[model samples]
Target: MDTAENRLNPPSQLLLALEVRGILELQAFFAAYPLLRYAPRGDGHPVLVLPGLGASDISTRPLRTYLKAQGYAAHGWKLGPNHGPRDGVEAGIDSRLADLAGRYGRKVSLIGWSLGGVFAREAARRAPELVRQVITLGSPFANEPKASNAWRLYEILSGRKVDDWPGREAMKLPPPVPSTAIYTRTDGIVAWQGCREQYSPTTQNIEVEGSHSGLGHNPAALYAIADRLALPEDDWSPFDRSGLRSMLYPDPLRSDTDSEAALRVSLAV
Candidate 1:
């Protein structure tokens, strides 16, 4: 009973075309590497990084490396490429989560990119006691399956219909642990609105300016991730965007002006 009228549309061609900016974003990350080192340091906790659709642990290497440098035991899913929730995908994540938590004797934080974020959220939901928090990068968790440009590719890769995925409705619900959804208005793959989490005491949406493909390595996104991960396990607070951060990360909750709304409409189209 789903219809185009009811489902959010994928990003427009303009946004899709802008995905190439990911290259520049990557360069920017390297250019700012020295500066990034001063971003934030983390406790010696375990952190799991999951890749997006069709991407392997390779895509997350830079992020995992950065986390490791920040004093956390960063890990990759090690399950080949992410091809949706195929047979053993869920089990693999569960096993990894248990293994890391058991080894570290501490709850692990989950940071996922794109489809990986969906997996991370669900993993935390299934085992909140084992998860410290969840952070998603450019993940359209709140949208219908077809609302992303990669839906067809996801089907082709996973051999599963996007709409037929079980527990699809529950995907929109934020996990019990602290959750952060990082999104970009100029994202080239998924509708930016779909990347938002329902606001709650422990749920937040961070608007970063970057391409969907580069969120994993984008400097602003990277700093935000480091900032979030550096928080104490027992003390959770919404991200502070005051001072210089305000200029880099726009207020997601601010009322969009006519121009902003128009731009959003264009991207959604």
Candidate 2:
């Protein structure tokens, strides 16, 4: 059963104000960031992007475009809308992975947003050998039914219970190969704790400062993603205090508290 604390935290008025301002600031930053104009790494491993619930491929186009410019082969799930669980969904994902593997001659990296992250993790569990890494943005993996603010709305729209995770109980996550779960404490859509994966040797959780909706577009988030992907296959390391500080306080020219306060305001909203 979902506890009261497990549900989404209501946004405060201040949070709403900050989010509006943050949105503008974030957009400007993305526009100015020259690094995002090109791929961070030139190696050509395929990256599959799965959009959040109710989001289409178009929603992920900015990141996709940046990735393409950087020289990575990025693709979105060509299957129609991302409504949770319909018939043969698992098989369809498997087929997609197989096809990409055959064409690329390498395991594919998956970057999933929101519920799409859950799907990516499940796919990796099914075919570890075919997945190079898994990254999820603002995903809810630890909670049961009604834990997320969208639970009721999602059920109403899709007519399916998403909390049911058959075969998920016994399934151990594939040995972590550069897996990164990026989430924000200020997420308005899902409980922040739900975004946490139980600590494991292979899995690492990164806390970012942004709203749930802005994660995919946040400049800081994108920089982190690019940095992670750019790491050599053997160089993957758990996010340490040094790395976190560097990411959170990348610019000596700007005040870190501005971003930190913005994150707090977003959560309050």
Candidate 3:
């Protein structure tokens, strides 16, 4: 028989439970509100979604489909599987952003998950005029390299040193363009502190109840994304806590330091 400690500590078991819980929560939230099905429509500027480290475009299929159904021109980063820092990767990202902007005839919105979020922010910083807005899910930006246990595994697999990677420096925010970062306290992968952003008027940090692996399918995250995308071109504002009191406790954006600490402790357990 498996001991309670062993069962709880096993990476596979814990990850599976988190994934299951995330799916159940998503179903319950969507079922409660039928009107939440509405997705933004029209030939709006393209929204490019980037997958996390080691994730291929397939991982983001659900999100892309949902965005398309909502009427937005959503696209995947078709640049092969994300394999960490590599030669020509940065240039490739620039080319993709430029191509999308030229084709759409407007600034493109970026929605990156995990490491893809880091890349999206960097692209926005490099060309703010060409980029309209950015949204990231469960990205780690505040902490230094090696902050998360998973980073060690990633480093070993990719044979690249994260500390030497330029992406780490690019995590810094650029000029204000409506930005929203959604994270959860129960994330079993990256530290929640890494997902936070501060010191910007247009930036928002939304705290949802979920695990990192299932953020793409979480109902609260979907609703939040829909809400942000639906906002009129000029009405983009920081996240407001007045309405979400029932959803998440203690607004995660109250203060960067406190929120980061609280989130870190919550996820450590």
Residue pairs with clashing backbones, model 3: 40-70, 140-194, 141-194
Clashes of each: 0, 6, 3
lDDT of 1 by residue, 9-122 (tens): 888877788889889998998898889889889999999999999999999998998889888999999999999989999999999999999999999999999999999999
Better of 1 and 3 by TM-score: 1
Distance from true position, residue 164, model 2, in Å? 2.9
Could you give candidate 3's per-residue lDDT for residues 30-63 as a string of tens digits?
A: 5734544753453466888998888888988877
How many steric overlaps does candidate 1 have?
0
lDDT of candidate 2 at residue 245, scale 0 to 100:
63
lDDT of 1 at 186: 79
What TM value does model 3 have?
0.80
> Over all chains combined, what TM-score does candidate 2 have?
0.80
Predicted model with the maximum lDDT? 1
TM-score for each predicted model, relative to the true structure:
0.94, 0.80, 0.80
The candidate 1 region of ten consecutive residues with least summed lDDT is 255-264
Candidate RMSDs in order: 3.0, 5.0, 7.1
